[model samples]
Target: MRSSEGMPFSVVTGALWLDLVYTGGEGDRSCWEALHTPTDVAAWAHSSGVVSDPSAVRIDEADLRAAHRLRETLWDMANRLADGKLPTSDAVAHLNAVAQRADPVPQLVLRSGVLELDRGRNADGAQVLSAIARDAIALLSGPHADRVKRCAATDCALLFVDTSRPGARRWCAMSRCGNRDKARTRRRFEKG
Candidate 1:
């Protein structure tokens, strides 16, 4: 959906790990390169909700490489699960290794006189990736594993976690692929 300012909304797949995968786009077409530089990775970390402040996070060339590797591995595994195939043992091992790299240190903070658990602003690239990988582990191994799906649009292969009540979601975003498919179908019917 476009905002009042006429900018399209950012589509989130209900999970940060899946969000990372979508950054690479589908097939030969790329949405945009969000990990081209260490600075870009830092910005993505903040925008993707991996960190609170982009400036506070330290991302280096090595970190960028690691992020790219983890993202591709995750995309492959997610697509496999969506296609009713089991993830390979090697992919599982890589995920485990990334997740064990560095976990974000959680801090209990007092907000409005209530205690809340939060990953504070200060973090490194490895910590950001580990958090994402850890989330992937939980999602792949958890009850919602079967809910993973690729968009039904023939040309769009974005993977998403189907959190609908009936688990019947067929589009990455209704405003995008879903609407396009509906319009195409209507046109075909008119032609008939």
Candidate 2:
């Protein structure tokens, strides 16, 4: 739920895995590399709502690499679904393996006079990644599997779950790609 500028592929899709996959970007010049370092991974986990404390998470080089690998596999599967195809067996197996990792232990915390579930302070990178893997499994296998779609914007390769009531969502975000597209169309009509 962060700002689009902070994370281009924010939780508008309501899937942590999609947000992780989107950290890479659409392979365009504006692509965002949010997982460049261990610290970056920690920051992403915190900002993506996976972890409550970035400093409490210990991310090493191996964890960073693993995150990249998981992100790539998720991205591949998302692209497949977006293209009206199913994910490959190997990708599914990879996702299953990642999902098997130790998950973060949930702790009820009192925040602003409300109790909410938050990950334990000892939550590591693997645990955070496992949470994302589980989210991917749910989104891709549950009833919303068919709702997965790619943004209609030609320049944007972002994938999002169509949570609209009619399931007719096209752009990644109305303020971002959708507005740009509408403005583009308006300019074309005006010129004509």
Q: Which predicted model would earn the best TM-score?
A: 2
Tell me the deviation in Å of residue 2 in model 2.
14
Predicted candidate 2 versus true structure: per-residue lDDT over 1-192, tens digit per residue: 334457443338757898888677445412567778998988899887888778888889998989999988988898899899999999999999989977778789899999987764788788888889999998888878888898898887667999788899998888788888999999999999
Per-candidate TM equals 0.83, 0.84
Cα RMSD, model 2: 3.6
For each candidate, what is the lDDT?
0.81, 0.82
Query: Which candidate wins on lDDT?
Result: 2
Give the worst 10-residue stretch by lDDT in candidate 1: 25-34
Model 2 clash number: 0
Candidate 1 per-residue C-alpha lDDT over 137-175 given as tens digits, one digit per residue, 9 for 90 to 100 = 988788788888988988876778987788889988888
